[model samples]
Target chain A: MMLIDTLAQGLLLGGLYALFAAGLSLVFGIIRLVNLAHGDLIILGAYLILTVTTITGLHPFVAVLLAASLMFGLGWLLQTHLLNRVLGADILPPLLVTFGLSVVIQNGLLSGFTADSRKLAAGAIEAQSVDLAVVTLGVMPLLTFASAVAVIFALNRLFYRTALGRAFRATSDDAVTAELMGIGPQRIFAGATGIALAVATIAALYLGTRANFDPSIGPARLLYAFEAVIIGGLGSLWGTLGGGIVIGMAQALGASVNPERQILSGHVAFVVVLLLRPRGLFPRASD
Target chain B: MTPSRPLGLIAAFAALAVLYALPAIAPRALVQDLFGVLTLLVLALNWNTLAGFAGLVSVGQQAFVGIGAYAMFAAIILMDLNPLVGVLIGGLAAAAFALPMAFFAFRLNGAYFAIGTWVVADIARLGISQWKALGGGTGTSLPKGTAKDMAFVDRIKAALDVSSAAAADALTYWLMLTLAVAMLVAGHVFLRSRMGLGLQAIRDNETAARSVGVDPVRLKALVFLLTAFGTGLCGALAFIQITRVTPDAAFSVIDWTAFVIFITVIGGIGTLPGPIVGAVIFYALQRLLADYGTIYLIVLGCLGIAVMLFARRGLWGVFTGRTGIDLLPLTHRPPKSAAPQPQASRRTA
Candidate 1:
């Protein structure tokens, strides 16, 4: 029973982490470019929600939709105007360029909003809990985990079932061949970044509700996302969730032993996995 | 060509000597600021060597810097050595650690290499923070008396007591200026050597480099160690300037890599003086916009995006194309007109 409880809580937290890693994974899979700015973009999305929520006094869920749409546009513009040009054979340019973007976003948020942390007002729903025979779960956390499953399922279906999804997979497989097949690489990348940012918006909603967020916290979030992506293997969505569960369990277990070990434990787990599987747990066969 | 090289070297040395004498003449505060910026310049240049020329974009250089700073603080506070010597030794110890790390990390390709560096940095931080000897999470200060005993501080005190403003400013100025010059010269010489050529070849195409008998793995490891050595040295200099060391301050991955990336990208990657230009511009922008903290980052981001999209070669590439000036001259061969005459080239130019 106790083990079930631990697994349940970990899988839920895994949802939030999967959300964080989803955007990161998609961008990497489609473009082979790591978006260092991903975590900051999530923070940016949260700030957008905070702004709209405060202004309209809407529920956090409603605010999330607005934020997601805005982020989708921002992501599209960012790719079309900036990132698309730097995506190429050489990796350094994109890495350096995105790093600068992360810094800039963090600082921009810092200045726009003071360093003081803010959280979305989730009301009683946030405090509400669902009780199972063996354990109780917070509604927000359960929803977050469910959403992660839904997102992965939806993305997988979209990737394999729909025409647009076929284009995305085709482009990921071979951009030149996709272009030969009448798919525009630029348009596909723009669409992927847009979808990634939308996922980031959902992540921001949970991140804001689950804990306090300030500008400085984005890099830590990025660290978790990177770990998840690496742990699960780079391109697989299901693998990302597994990676997050592994990390989440490690942190929880480490915390059980020593509170200070919480963060350290996750990192140690990542390193241990790397030692055992240098290419990651589920590196893409093509990759 | 040798004669011209000597003249350049002498001029650089003379410039250093003159600057070293400036702290005596300049304001005390200004001298200190210059020293701080110079240390940052050293770090930026070293990062440029690794990420820029070698095509290895490491996001965790803070590992080396943090280790060096901790080692320095530990040596001075516990071992009772000359603080300056302690700092140098700290740098060497970091290099020793880096040598072994490079072997494991260099095995991974581009993105994996970067992620591996970050993991290594996190591991170092975890080890340091958990070890009570290093003050763990809260961090510890250097031995209290060491700051007063530092040679730079003593020199500054003497100048201040004598009211020799120019003399004090000059000494501090000269020290920082000399270190910065040495770092650049070393960077230049390294890039022009056989190892540097091998790194460039690998950067251009790893398969091709191996086809020509270049060991990509070994060359990358060497570059990693050398870059760590320089970065470690920079950390020591930073410790001297700040007079303290803390985990967050010393191991700030963000500060170490972010501004360096901006400088390298904006100035031009894979070129020696790119970081120098980037640092100067970055420092200037920071000073000018100190009060607008968040806006400063936004501007930096927008600038980076702009540079990546339009000025891919960076500000140096732009200026050089427009005006044809070669100031720092990290490029290996001169322009066609500047290259040796056909006869001179055949005669071992």
Candidate 2:
């Protein structure tokens, strides 16, 4: 029963990890550019939500809706105006530029929030729980997991079933060829980033409610997201969820053995997965 | 032949002499400031060697820096070794650690490789933080006895006519100055060597270089280890100056990797003189704007982004492009008279 409960908790925790990584995987898939600032952008979304909730006295979910739309526009403008210029043969420019952006976002938050950790007021939902046949699960974790599944499903449907998804696939396959075929790669990239940021806003909602966050936490979050993305395999959304679960389980199991080993266990799992499957568990067939 | 080579050498030596004599006349604070600058210069050179020449952009260099600091602390606290020797131990430990990390990181390409290094560094930090003997996450300070008994502290105190603390500062500054000069000379010499040519070829195109019998993996691994060694030395020197070792401070990506990358990119990548120019500019900026706190970092990030987007070649690149001067030439250019002779002979033959 104890082991089953631990596994259940781990799988639920993986849901949150998947949320953090979904935006990262989405952006990487569309543009072949890894934004080092992806984690910072998530935190930015969280802060935006916090601000909305504070100003409007609305529910956090409502605040997320507002933050998501705002972030989408911000993402679109960022890609169109800035990221597009740096995208090319050399990978250094995009990576460094994003790193610079990461620094900027982090410090900007620091200046505004003064490095104090903040959490969202989620009311009764924060302490609610659900009972299964063998174990109990927190309502927040269950919601996070459910949301992760919905987000992934929606993203997959959009990619395979929607015209915009077709554009993304075509653009990802070959930007120049897609452009020649009347698909504007620039616009596609902007849309992709916008969508990614919208997903980031959802991740932020859970992040703010589930745990405390500060300006400095973004990079550490980025580490976990990157690990999950890699473990799932690059460019594979489902793989990302699997990767997150693996890490979550590892951390949970490590904590069962020794509390101090929790984080280290997740990192060790990442390295082990990397060593065993360099391309990840479900690397994109195209890649 | 370029007329600048001989003049450059003379100027370099003269600058070294000036730096050597600086502690004698300069205030203690200024010496400490220059020490910080020189430490950063060493780090920039190491980063430049890896990213600029070898095409390996690692944001996890703090892994080595942190390891080096902890290694030094262990030597001082547990092994009861001289701090000077601990510096060397720290460097070797970092290099040894790099071997395994490179095996994992090298399997990754481009941006994945960058993040892979960061993950490794984070893992190291977490692991190191568990060792309660080293004060865990809270960290530890070098014992007062160790500081008082550091190598050459007495000699420096007598020579500088100063107290023990001032003498220690002077000693550290001189050690950093020597290491900085050595790194510059060594970097220049390495880049002019055959391996440097292979590394550059690999950077341009890995598969093409491999076809030409240049082992990209071997060259990259070698450079990675070498840079780790130098970075470890810098980390040890930095911690020695502070006489304290904390996991957070030692493994700080912002201080170690981000600033170094910014300096390298903003000065110029893929050039010998670029890091030096970049380091000077960075030190100047820090001195000027450090009082503003987070604003200074924001300005740095903004400047880094601006430079990457608008001036990719950086300040040194612009300077060399406009003036057509190569003070430290890594590429050999035959004389005008000698250049046509080979082509003419080949045509006639």
Please compute DockQ, using alpha carbons, for every candidate against the native two-chain complex.
0.63, 0.88
Tens digit per residue, CA lDDT, model 1, B1-349: 3235566567757866666665556667777777766777777788778887777788778888888888887777778777778778768877987975776576567876786787778777777788677688888876555555556665666655644334433444565577678888888787778877778778778899999999977787778888888788778667755666677878887666666667677776666667777777877887888896566667777787788778777787776566554445544555678755532221110
Q: Which ten residues in a row have the lowest lDDT in candidate 2 chain B?
A: B340-349
Task: Please give the C-alpha DockQ score of model 2.
Answer: 0.88
TM-scores, all candidates, are: 0.92, 0.97
In terms of docking quality, model 2 is high
Clashes of 2: 0
Q: What local lDDT does model 2 show for residue A82?
A: 95
lDDT of 2 by residue, B153-220 (tens): 99988988888888888888888888887887898888878888788888878889999999988999
Residue-pair clashes per prediction, in order, are 16, 0
User: In CAPRI terms, where does candidate 1 land?
Assistant: medium
Candidate 1 yields a Cα-based lDDT of 0.78
